[model samples]
Target chain A: MDRIPILKIGAALLVTIQVDLHDSVAMALEEDLSNMIVKAGAKGVLIDISALEIVDSFIGRMLANIAGVARMLDADTVVVGMRPAVAITLVELGLSLPGVKTALNAERGMALIQRRVAESGLEADHAAGEF
Target chain B: MRIRQIVRAAALEAGLSLVDQTKIITAASELARNTLDHGGGGHASIERLQEGGRRGVRIVFEDTGPGIPDVDAALRPGFTTGRGMGLGLSGARQLSNEFSIATEVGRGTRVTIARWK
Candidate 1:
């Protein structure tokens, strides 16, 4: 089973997807991200899909599920780096990914997560201070 | 994923635009997964088409599993008999320039889609 790496950056977890994911791999990623959110007490989740060439309905559903799960666990998810063609195709494929937030790139995605975390009033220092 | 790669290569070989390549590849992925999950596994093939100086790419997915009983209902968005988003068949239809499906109750199902450059 192949696993996509998830790096804990600041108060969020960053996932840079650099491969075309198989169905099983995408499911695994969703499960792993859920566990990581609870384990790391993550405030946000950022998935970078700039390297991916397509976002099929399966992958689109996976993204929506991840966001739903993260929200239930008190975390936010932001998907970043969708190629122009992929974005156009996604809409045509009838997948708007209703609940998933997206940004143009990873840098901006991280900033969006940080802002959300800040607005949520979850003090990063306090969370770190307790540990 | 391999199916998608083959579709992408075929689309490019047929001179599809970047967005068109993505469209066909994505549509192929959706249909291929449907064959595996709902049809109990199948095969996909890519076809390069040419007619009157027009070039295009066509993909065919065939499965021998339990065929869809209600294709009209299945083609409706948000209709699913499996654990999917119910967008595979309809979404694939939307992403392609030409689409067709042939199926029987217990026989099998064949879906073909084409995109012209």
Candidate 2:
């Protein structure tokens, strides 16, 4: 079977996980992504879920957990390209990761991350009154 | 066998990339198995929908087994009522775009999910 693949971009890492988002695999994938972010020293992570059809509670929590771990590693996480039905299911199920950012597409997600990085730097410079 | 095949086929037909289709299939298989194992048996249906020019697929799994008494607790991550890892409901909810559940004591449980193409 073709399992999920981790795609690395320049500085920004994209983990293209295409898992059934089911039971055991869901848990395992969450752990795997968490470890990968820490080990890779990636500055940003994008989760492309354009393929998923369902979103259960365990999967929701796991995604949130992965995001938490990535943040601890100083890598931002963005979920991208979810189908509308899948989005509705997640909301109906009451499974959500509040505060975790998401984008309609991967490109936008990457751009958002870049902007965050730039904004943080600009804010620090301004605090020091640096031009 | 039919359920498994249906799940797999539906995942692919739903426009999930090959890798994502597999993930969705896996999730559906596990959930279908649980329906048989825990619910004693159930029926699932799949269909395609187009809303506002966007396409997607929806799957509904319904069972007449003993209704879950504490749905809130049952949905907790890592909590299982069966011997298996309690990831079925939770996992399925994660892999799709929408998930909804309706059930009553001694009646039945109905789960609806959709994944857009």
Candidate 3:
């Protein structure tokens, strides 16, 4: 089975997953992603999904769970690169996902994370000065 | 399998934050499997949307198979008509910003969900 790829980029982590959008694999992937978030201690996450052709209810639920786990770990997450057709299909099916952040592409997502990190650093610096 | 993969892909593509994408995909995968297992194999649709100025992904699962008789009961969190864990419908709903179901006894079932971006 082709599994999703997980990588650490700077303080963030990138998960590149290629999925058939079918059955048991989807379930396993969900579990894997959740575990990665908990174990990796990443400051952020980027998921690349340009290869998927379908979206179903089970997968939707899993994604939501992964997001929840990432949050608990104090890491931000971003989804990138979706096909338009698949997007429409998911909407028509009435599937919903929660606790996930979205971006247009990986580059943009990474940049967003960088900016977030910078902002946080600035906040910390200011607090230090005050102290 | 296919549905789960697709959910993961879509979640990532939608630029969902890592934590958000994981949770949404997990919940979506469960619901997609339920659609196939109980509904006799159906196709799921996904879309990215912006509502009230908030961006998110929208997913729909449609099946021509036997529809649910009691949607309310089915969504009761612990309710299950099958042997697996009963968290499919309820969990999906909890993971998304909006979840709705439309079904007819002899017709079919349609589930609509919106997870804001």
Candidate 4:
């Protein structure tokens, strides 16, 4: 029943996935992120997966699902810090993560979210401060 | 998660490269989930393989639930009977160096995959 913590920064939500998540834990994360976006009026979501060693089909689908739900809730989701090996395996696993936006690191991910927020005219002044 | 750790250790012990280790571990995860969700719970076996001078790791997932009726269709990408994205079986096959599947409609399913170092 462990839940991944969601931190709110400016108008965005940040999640650092440091564990090789169990299926139920991943599901709970998706649900928790959805609720946090609505409750905090978050315009962007940043998920850091650099620490995770692997992403199977289940985790890949979870990322896509999070992006889909965020889009539906009027928010953008950016996944960052994927290791090279993990990226190669993900693509080989037949998942391109069609709808999820990715960044090489957290700085770029925050920038992508901020740019989108600025373009969308949704609280453009809120800066994504240092993590 | 225990399965993942076990697979990783086995792959490392078998002298698989980092990328190779990652591939086999991911494949084991996908197949294990299929065994649990689609096959109604099962077991996994890990083996260290040595042939001539080459080393490898092999994983086998077995289940007694309703087996896949059409393995060809099941192995095809983007095919699913459940809520999954339909990449588990096909993806697992692609990740491993050797793959084999045996299933009977009313009996059970067994998927064996191996990766060489």
Candidate 5:
């Protein structure tokens, strides 16, 4: 099975989704990301979806799922680089991914994550809850 | 769905705007998945069109299987025979300019959708 790489940067994790994900692959990614956050004591996750050509209802649900789980794990997930085409499709598919924050690109996403973490408080408070 | 990608390309080649390109491609994806999942795998066809002084793209997904018993029920959101959210049929319909479905129980199913440029 192909695995999407999760790169840990400082207190954050960055993932670039460049494949047309099969259902199992997407499920694996969600699991992998959850485990990585606990092990790394990460505060943020930045997922880039610009390379994906389409965002169906299934894929839309997957994004929301990742965000939902990440929040429960005490991490902020920012889905970044959504192309104009994907944005239009997702809306029509009846999914807005309400809980997932988004950014124009990776740089801005990183900034958003950093700002969020800063406002929430420093590392020790959240790190102690790590799994 | 590979057909989704192809249909999107065809819609683009037909000179539809960026938004329409995505919308048509998304519709094709939902229908193609239905053909494969419910119809036990099938094929699809896509074509560029110029009809009635308008340009657009059309895609047809066909499968020979236990066809839909009631299309009306299938078109309702959150209705599914499987463990899915059942947004494919209804969401796809909402995304296209033109959508049509034909199915005969125990024979086959065919869904055709188009979007004008």
Candidate 6:
């Protein structure tokens, strides 16, 4: 079975989607990510999708779903490396990806996630509870 | 599956912007899925073309299933006969430079879309 690897980097969980994901794979990712965030007690999540060739509405929805679940689990998600064409296409697809945060690249995304975590007092909550 | 791969390769080979390549590939994915789930499985074709000195790519998807009974409604966003967000058709049109669809009630459906460089 094809599986997207999840790497634990200090206080954050980084997921680099490097393959063309089947719909089933995408769903599996959503479930896996949600579980990882809780098990790892991660404060931030950085999803690198620069290698993705497509962000069709389905994929677009999956991204939003991840962001939503991550937030509920007390993890900040910063999606990075979105190609401009994918951005334009997503809007055209009527998906503004509300509630999802985005960054230009992995570095920027990591920084953004950290900054968001700091601003929202996420780190303190991590000690107070399993985030 | 194979159709999406072909479309992705063709879109990239056209030297389109990374974003544009993604857009076409996304559109291809949605349309191809529609062909399979709704059209009961079919075939799709792609063409790299140069018309009026402008280079572009075209993707055509055909399926012989229960054709759409109301195309006008289907073209509108959020109108789906199947379980979907109803953004596939409308979203594809938004991503392409040109979009057209033809279907017969008892026959099949054909959708063509092209993006220029």
Q: Report fnat in order of the candidates.
A: 0.89, 0.00, 0.09, 0.86, 0.68, 0.77
> lDDT per residue, candidate 1, B1-117, as tens digits?
678778888888999999999999889989998999888999888899999999999889999988989999999988988778999999999999999999998989999999999
Error of 2 at A119 (Å): 3.4
* Candidate 6: tens digits of C-alpha lDDT, residues B1-117: 677678767877777776777778788888987888789988788999776877778999999988899998988988888766778888888888889999998788999998777
Stretches > 4 Å off in candidate 1: A124-131
- Model 2 reaches an interface RMSD of 7.3
Candidate 3 lDDT, A12-72, residue by residue in tens:
6787767454445656666676676666545678878776544445445556666777788
Residue-level lDDT tens digits of model 6 in A1-131: 68788987656789998877787898888899899998978877888988876777677777878889998998888889987777777877787877788889988877776676677776675445433
- Give TM-scores of the second chain, every candidate: 0.97, 0.87, 0.89, 0.98, 0.94, 0.94
Which of the predicted structures, 3 or 4, would earn the higher TM-score when compared with the native? 4
Model 4 error, position B52 (Å)? 1.2
RMSD of each: 2.0, 9.0, 11.5, 1.9, 3.1, 3.2
Expressed as tens digits, the lDDT of each residue in A1-131 for candidate 1 is: 89998998877899988887777898889899999998988888999899889888888888899999999998888999999999999888778897899999889987887787788787655357442
Ranking by TM-score: 1, 4, 5, 6, 2, 3
Compared with the true structure, all predictions reach lDDT values of 0.89, 0.68, 0.69, 0.91, 0.86, 0.81
Q: Give a tens-digit lDDT track for model 5, residues A1-131.
A: 99889998767899999988888999999999999999988889999998987788777778888999999999998999999878877877887786899999999998898787778777555544442
Tens digit of per-residue lDDT, candidate 5, span B37-77: 89998879998999887899988889998999999999998
Q: What TM-score against the true fold does each predicted structure earn?
A: 0.94, 0.55, 0.52, 0.94, 0.90, 0.85
Per-candidate DockQ versus the true complex?
A: 0.84, 0.11, 0.09, 0.86, 0.71, 0.71
True contacts kept of 1: 0.89
Best by DockQ: 4
- What TM-score, to 2 decimals, does candidate 1 have? 0.94
- What are the runs in model 3 whose C-alpha is more than 4 Å off? A21-31, A122-131, B1-32, B39-117
The candidate maximizing lDDT is: 4
Q: Pick the winner on lDDT between candidates 2 and 3.
A: 3
